[model samples]
Target: MRMMLKAVVLWGALAVAAGFASIGAVHAADKAGSKIEVQKSKSPTTQKAKARPVSKASSSQRVAQKGKVASRVSKAKSTRVAKASPSAARVGGSKSSRPTQKGKNVAPAMAGGVDLWQGQEHLAVRSGSALVIAQDGGEALYEKNARIVVPIASITKVMTAMVVLDSMPNLQAPITITDEDVDYLKGSRSRLQVGSVITREMALLLALMSSENRAANALGRHYPGGLPAFIVAMNRKAASLGMSRTHFADPTGLTSNNVSTAHDLARMVAAAYRYPLIREFSTTPGATAEVKGRELEYRNTNQLVKSPTWEIGLSKTGYIQEAGKCLVMQARVADRPVVIVLLDSSGKQTRIGDANRIKRWMESASASGKATPA
Candidate 1:
């Protein structure tokens, strides 16, 4: 009986041991499944973290493109501004327009009549002293330092002729070119040789058309009180014409002391235009003179006078180192009578260019009914 009981106890202990081993295996499998799930969730988190760098790079590229676009837009705006401004337009006479190197700065005057203002595109002149006025009422249309004083080289001849005519001198009187008529100051060459003889009318014509210093000197020398009296008369005439800023030291205009403002020159031009003799002489494009039995052909000093495109009533050109190229004229432009004065120009062609620019600007302004100020 004892032996059978011991065997039963041993069998019971083996069955319990097997049941514990099975339970332990199930617990280990559950722990392994939980670890796998945690690893799977961590894989998605790592992928999301890797994708963030690419998103940041794309954002940086978008910002860079925006900056480039803004730069292009700014450049376009700058170009437009430059095109609309006249400050970029070249101004100065000679080969180019230069700003005033000497002289007091004067404020620009307002355009008062007919309002013919063409913006900077119309009146880029190199002359330091300039003016444009309507002949009908003497209204200033455009001006640049018009009130400033400056030397007017052969422009003195206009006043000299006026004084000669006002004195009622014989137009047919004989005027001889002598050593006294030679330009001693500026050493300017003259086509009329010493002892050349011509009628007073011819001398006047040569003086106005060819800008002959000798002819002008002869005219002044024969005046009522001689050359001294002639100079006094010129000042008197300028004063009478309200040319407050004008003065003349000689009729030849070789002296730098012969000075006048553009405004005063415009007035002088207007006064001279009324004289039939001056109008005829100054506007003559070409003429021939007999000097020592040789017929010498002389052309007008003003180039515009020879152009068929210009209907100049009165014209004069004057030049000296002190006084750059100078010109004054009364012309019919845009169907209106106008006076133009250019002074202290630097270039040989700048004055003519300025006149053409004014003409084109005036025509365009009249057509469009918009006048721009220079």
Candidate 2:
């Protein structure tokens, strides 16, 4: 009986110790579960930083971080796109569906393309207006304000010669210079004095070759119906030549009302080139006329006609304060017929320099296959 009671007490102590150890283990597991819950309750941004790539976030993360954080991320992305657009357009389109910024200006660049010969170096000229065109081809090789009309100065003489020849007037008839033939308006002097008598043909020759204002006036005065009638005829002839922009206020071009564009002057030069007498008389280097039994020599007004380098077919030069130095010509350049008109040239030698530069450019174009075929 004593042995049984001792064994029973020892068993009771062992059972109580086992129960306490189980309770302690249950409390440890509950505390561990509570720590996991605390970690899961963190803010979305912190969770996202820990869980996602720094460069990009998942849509779910963005939605999870709604309000201020999401708005900030969206705004930053839009700003980045806006800053990249211009550079992307310069390099090439960033997106294939989006139109490039540079695409709008492409057509104008092609339309006003650089000349075939003027690849890098543009031809520098001083004339206020100029035009260089192939005679038969109608190809404009060069142009500068060619359509703007201004006073044509004595380039009017070419038209005067054309009209005089058009009338088929009696070439050998005597014409007397009078006070009416004098340039009273401008006070411009003339070598042809009053009462000087010359044949109509000589007057025409002097008018064209020497740019003799009195000679031109005498020719106009001797017309079938006089100076006013002659002015009417001048306008009629200009209209006939398709020189729509040209207007002749007087036969001498002394009046600034005598306005014409380089484009119209080119047409006039082309028409003048057709008349054989005008061509011969205008290009004659020098001639002598007998006035009051005294012989006076009158040289051609154009200096280029005397130059060996020029193969000028028809040429004229004119100047006044209102109209700066002006020149027009029909010449064969690089074996091709071309018409050149230079107007309002300020420098004394700028017209000649421009002509030389044009010739050199044409020759260069021909050599390099840049010239348009005739």
Candidate 3:
């Protein structure tokens, strides 16, 4: 009881102090209105820890606890604010907005302000890795140990898609989702089921978009020359892409030896980008279909797809005990196309947060670009 009271008192003091925090001038003019006050934070803002006002179950508290909708007015205001235009973003705060041609209304945010990863260990920590985003041509953002070779888990599927697309392009080709396709792919979420009848194209969608191991395996099994031929082709495709550091032992990224550096993976993503189908599939979100009389639901593995600030063109997510959490993406930020690769992130959410951090860093750098005030 005393601790709670003290917490409440501290919260009040902080709130009062914030009102006089002397944040100087930060304002925003938006399409909706110009009343937004984006005060320049003197210190990194701490998120209000959401501790409900000491229980007692008020109507509002109940609603929030149950995850029920907040008041309609608040929700509408939030939605409108999130959809704020670039012009409005310029009204105040260091909010940086970039254009994106693909996803609707989402502005690509650059690695915050340029040297996002600078001074912050230029390489992955131990099992971790980072990239030096390139500005010219189609090469990696610079890398170290990126190609030292590690188990890639689902990162392997990008290569599988490349090989399968090379060998199998007929969308109308009928294929059955057999038990072999669904075998050994335990613990991973998938919509592919045994005995489901789907087109070859559908299998590819699941393999790449949904990371359905069963779908990937089924595609491999359905290869005209079977698994051996499929493996041979996958290797051949890697060599053809000039990915000397990569080797594929399976169609799915589940195997331990499915190794590739962030650099090689970047090359893989660039190659994948050439295929319009791959791009379409990689960026697809929340698609549905029926297989074998059962409803199949597919959702994008990347949550940033729903972000209002990202113009993600193509993306993939991978994870396994051996590979940790991995993500690779191509998105335009500050109108510059950048490919981001974060491998072996410690937590499931860290990779995504890292992307956001990088975006913020880039924006900060761009805002002050090579200029010293007189």
**lDDT of every model, 2 decimals:** 0.81, 0.79, 0.68
Alpha-carbon error at 55 in model 3, in Å? 75
Candidate 3, 23-79: lDDT as tens digits = 422222242244322332322232222334444457667877656455676777754
Q: How does residue 168 of candidate 3 score in lDDT?
A: 54
The candidate that achieves the highest lDDT relative to the unseen native structure:
1
lDDT of 2 by residue, 224-263 (tens): 8999989899999999988899899777877788889988
For candidate 1, lDDT tens digit of each residue in 241-282? Answer: 999988899997888999999888888999999999898899
- The lowest-lDDT stretch of 10 consecutive residues in candidate 2 is 103-112
**How many angstroms is residue 368 displaced in model 3 relative to the true structure, after the best TM-score fit?**
1.6
In the order shown, the candidates' Cα RMSDs to the true structure are: 7.9, 10.2, 31.1
Residue-level error in angstroms, candidate 2, position 321: 1.2
Instruction: Tell me, by TM-score, which candidate is best.
Output: 1
Model 1 TM-score on a 0 to 1 scale: 0.70
- TM-score sort, best first: 1, 2, 3
Candidate 1 ranges beyond 4 A from true positions: 1-114, 118-122, 371-374
**Sliding window of 10 residues with minimal summed lDDT for model 3:** 98-107
